[model samples]
Target: MPALRLLWLGCLGSLCRAYFDGPLQPEMSNGSLHHYFVPDGDYEENDDPERCQLLFRVSEPRRCGAAPGGLSLRQELTVLGRQVEDAGRVLESIGRSSSYDLDGEESYSQYLRREAAQIGDAYASSERALSELESKFRQGREPEPRDGARPGDACLGLLLRARALLR
Candidate 1:
């Protein structure tokens, strides 16, 4: 079972990397693949108190502009992918340990539950941020694609599968 879980995780990771790093579809493309470096001064000035608070709480902030709080779609998807990976690791650990008779099973189960909840919350928050950025693009608030790559359905599917494994 553990081997099967590891195999699944490996496949999911590959799919995530391919999808997140791949080119965007025609409708999602903004025709600008150039990298935008955040200016030092602008980074400091654009750090609004509210935005900082949101960043602290959620780790993903919805920004309609090229400000310090704004993260490219690729960046956001990368973060989501990492979260999913972490969750998968936790699930894998639980599976491996389930076969052994351990004294700390109860406590370990609690810890796993907390970790899973945290991962779920972070996933939802990042998902919301992605949706908001997409909406901004649709509304013309963001003229160019922050990054030419969009994770699209692949990342979300992986996240959902990971979450299911946790359960």
Candidate 2:
């Protein structure tokens, strides 16, 4: 009975690998990367997104427009099976790496609880988003531009930055 329960928990945890935060917007433009040091809305005039330009900072390493880090969707789904085999191995490591989990015994416990709650919330949201995306993919629908330009073409130059973030 205990083993069966463990297996159930493992299966549930495996489902979570499909839920992940989407990728950050890839940097665009060539030449130096520009950014206004000021926070958004700090200056009314500087509020223009165009104001920001990539600056060549000697200390900060510039990232090339390469693929995103982490597993791709298929890869992640594949790993999900391994994780289901032993949720402890994956979940325990993730919990330990979190800062919340490192704040001493009491804090660690609190952190674990808090992080678990956060993960649950995030998982729900990701599931919903993924479902919508999957439907769109299956329908073979192209994103119509809200503006004149096509959807992601104007934004990230990729149809799905969210999908790219998976890799």
Candidate 3:
């Protein structure tokens, strides 16, 4: 059973993998954490990840420009949590399918336990991220300057709120 436990725990590592692979840094709400990430198409000259040059910063509504299509740093982290949860599911299913092959039932049992823990952890992390995202949206709607901004801002904010819900 202890061996099985370890195996299960090992499987949970996949969650970590998924979390890291997804987005890490999200866009800032105020665009203070701003940098012109190359929009989906062509890579700019000398576009090094570490050397992304800053164009400018937004201090007011007009300066903010369009709602960033690129996911924000926070959003990227949330996406990672979702991916981790998905990986956990895959691992659980795999374990289920291989349950009878008791090369060592003990090891198998451990694997299952580990995978389950991973899923739970992933779920919790994702939920926390989603809650934060939801809060951000609600804050965005507080009858202020953002209220009169372009409709796109509202729509994107709503989309982000919904995406957080997906987890």
Predicted candidate 2 versus true structure: per-residue lDDT over 122-144, tens digit per residue: 99999999999999897787745
Q: Which ten residues in a row have the lowest lDDT in candidate 1?
A: 53-62
| Per-model TM values vs. the true structure | 0.23, 0.22, 0.25
lDDT of 3 by residue, 28-138 (tens): 755455565655556756577665546445454333434667666678689989999999999998887777564445686787787788899999999999999999999
Give Cα distance to truth, residue 51, candidate 1, Å: 33
Using TM-score as the yardstick, the better of models 2 and 3 is 3
What tens digits encode model 1's per-residue C-alpha lDDT throughout 4-42? 999999999998887654434332134333323444456
* Candidates ranked, most accurate by lDDT first: 3, 1, 2
Please identify model 3 stretches exceeding 4 Å from their true place: 1-106, 145-167
Ranking by TM-score: 3, 1, 2
Q: State which candidate has the highest TM-score.
A: 3
Lowest summed lDDT over 10 consecutive residues: which window, candidate 2?
Answer: 57-66
RMSD of 2: 40.4
Q: What's the C-alpha lDDT at position 153 in model 2?
A: 68
- Say what the RMSD of model 3 is: 40.9
State which candidate, 2 or 3, has the greater lDDT.
3
